[model samples]
Target: MFVRNGTSTLKKVLTCPPTFLDEAAPINEISKKYQDQPLDKAKLLDEYQQLLDAYAEAGVQVEQLTPQESMTNSVFARDFGGCVKEGYILGSFKEPLRYAEHAAYEEKMAELGIPKILEVKKGLFEGGDFAFLRENIIAVGIIERTNMEGFNELKAGLEPLGYQVYPVPADSRYLHLDMCFNLVDDNLAVAYEEGLPTEFKELLNKLEIEIIKVPEEAIFQHGCNLESLGQHRVLSLKQNKDVNNALREHGMEVIELDITETLKAGGGPHCMTFPLHRV
Candidate 1:
């Protein structure tokens, strides 16, 4: 749960880093495999800072990322929960090879001034795949990165915090809920028309939220990724053409920034910025 704002609101968001547990745990290996990234690694860090700058420029209060051991995948860094009063739930990284990703969140949360970090021993939960749909209900994607154990942990922990958790089956290709849908605003979200199941759409419809259609291929491009900062404010990657159009068409003011490097690592602006609070 990264803050939509800047350092002014650090404690409000939750975040984590990558570590060695799974095959993707060693980042150095990744560097050896890919010689020329479509987006440069050095530039990715700069672009990530730029994305963070945008949030700061927009009155967003950011909490820095949680520190974990070096892992090959940033996806490991993202396997954390939104936020809870008692603490943030660190979901087990479904990639057994990367399962240790959850371990990093504890230190990150402590640095953010939130000392309590909760973990689910019984299930696997991924924050990337969970969405706070309404007052007490959250929609989670049941996939490889997230499992029944994660689902149960999210449900049991968040429900008592006044968040009702629901599971949505996902297409194996994308492997993440954010790859399919994201809460762009309080009343609207960008959803991949084909990436997610029909039942999930039906359930979302039941909540009265308007789902803006984002193409399946676009989602693979990470177009559906977004973060809501209240007051119709949004954080997203500038490269996602279709998603930007969908957000603007809905009358929401968009803050498009560059995060090509970060996204290529399997996440985008939403993945980089851990919003501390919405308001």
Candidate 2:
């Protein structure tokens, strides 16, 4: 039984190694907006290993995903799908380069005996735009990676399952909601206020969730993206010092790793992982 509530402590996670093709893919095609420097193969592999180690040190079981030789962006495994109470929801990709990534995931999910609750093939709907603010409340960002059709499909699938889907307009600058806002603790979150819509903030207020605003410039550094190890523990990028310090002040234990090479690919800890079970 795979289950995840997004904000809870992570117990098991799915990840993929930074394969040769992943780092060899055309950098321009992968992240045109960021125009990141070409990744160093050796450095990228080391950084990915450290990410897996962080989960191990936190007592979270790690399941390595099958790498796709023809795909470059498959290393960002979180975008492939999301784990729900019953099983998994296969996510659709907005970037043409990543469209084929989900096929590998389908095979893997089936091998693991996980059922597909929904397969969003109508339009683009990357998993990075989805998060659970509460068990019954799910927030989905209608961004470049996830469109209205995808949002509607998500709502249609989830609403019948007793979830209230809240749509947050995208800022365009941030590819996903996770880049601007992340649920840290039970009722606390780190957010890039400028990147989020006013209605999104108002919704958080209505839920009485505490929000810590990260500096605008830090959004590119993925300050709002981190992985929870449950019990207020987090896996964060050491380069995101300001946000790490802030999380520490809030009484969360932060395990930091330097992922400069990984960051060049435009993903942090949260983007690199797909949680299968959370406590």
Candidate 3:
């Protein structure tokens, strides 16, 4: 079945190679600083391959979406759309440059026979802002990328399906909810508390999900963007030493990969993958 929560065991996933990760045209503040120097395509490919290897080692079935030359941020597959227990929820892009990605994801979903449950037609809703906290609960980030209109639309559709949609307000600078908050275990999350609203933190506490606070210095490094592989396992960035160490201390099996090249484009392991099937 499609994933119901982020902390479930990832059995199958979709990804796109960094075929057009050009640093010249910046997408965020992180990429803007790297515009002076061109990205080393060779090194980037190597790093991406290593991520694929890590997934294979974990026994995850990988599917790839072909990237168009002009879609520089297409490598971040998680922004395309998201899956629910019943079907796929088509995403609407806020950035004009990412508008074409929705159509590509639609075609892929159709090809894979994944039924479409709802398509965001009002305002904007990127998949990066959609986070499933539990089987019947989801947190949608009401940030610059995903506005109240979009959140309302999603809530209207999902609430009928027994989902309790929570609106988490975050600064536009964080880009997406996954950037500042993500699940590392069924009962544990790694979050950059300063970047999120106090209510969001309170909500997590109310849910009994312990927090592994990520410092401001580690926020930009995508320290909180690690992926959960279920069974108390996580796929993280080798550079996020503190976060990885904390996971290990909590009895998690952390698989670290060096995706520094991909991080230059303002995404990490979690951002680079779209879950197709989870258990």
Candidate 4:
């Protein structure tokens, strides 16, 4: 059983290929709610390919799921499920359009010989809000997609496994906690002040974590949502010039990719991946 630590060296990951985006196709509720602008289908495909290539270069195996024509937001696979110390912990998406993805994640976990440890079935909880800070400290955001009920359920499941759950209140504008804070390396993290509450920062202080504050502009641009590939290596959006520079200045090897089209669908590099095994 492999443990699920986001900052660990990633061994294997799963992603969903961007589905066919027929702009002419009638707009669904999901698209209406999330997509702030028109999507460039071709760019989305190119961007995803670049992401896969980055993973390959980092010596990580990338597996992709067949695209679903009906689900426009399927590309953001991180919200579908999460990897824990025991096995996979499946999530129930708050949006109606994403609920169908539960079955897909379940099947993928089974194929990989990873048992389903638990499922957030009764209430909403997306993997995006769940953050594994250490071997025992787990930070969960009570945000739009994740509520108090879901937070309690996750705590109930993880407490037995020796985990301390910290509930962070997420800004309504941001989708998840990761939208504001993410681990850059062991004992280090990057966060956007505007998206974080004072108590949450105090909690990080108590944990003795070194925090790098990303400029407020970068937060809305999805700069804080970058992914760490262990050993101080990071993958961030190309457009996030300020944050990328900040990460590099802090001694991190930064890999940048243009995710303009993908961001339109409400995610960035970290949101695109569902890591299975990290060492």
Better of 2 and 4 by TM-score: 2
Instruction: Score each candidate by Cα lDDT.
Output: 0.61, 0.80, 0.85, 0.79
Ranking by TM-score: 3, 2, 4, 1
| Residue 233, model 3: Cα distance from true site in angstroms | 0.7
lDDT-based ranking:
3, 2, 4, 1
For model 1, how does the per-residue alpha-carbon lDDT over 111-200 read when each residue is reduced to its tens digit? Answer: 666545557677766667767776456788886567887677667766666666688887756667877788876668888767667877
**Residue 24, model 3, lDDT:** 40
**For every candidate structure, what is the RMSD over all alpha carbons to the true structure, in angstroms?**
4.7, 2.0, 1.2, 2.6
The C-alpha TM-scores of every prediction are 0.81, 0.94, 0.97, 0.92
Which model is ahead, 2 or 4, in terms of lDDT?
Answer: 2
lDDT, candidate 4, residue 189? 87
Stretches > 4 Å off in candidate 2: 21-30, 33-37
152-237 per-residue lDDT for model 3 (tens digits): 88999988989999999987778888888898788899988887788778888888998899886576799988889998999999
- Candidate 4 residues 212-244, lDDT tens each? 887765656787888889988999888888777
Clashes of each: 29, 1, 0, 0
Candidate 1 vs candidate 4, TM-score winner = 4
Pick the winner on TM-score between candidates 2 and 3. 3
Overall local distance difference test of candidate 4: 0.79
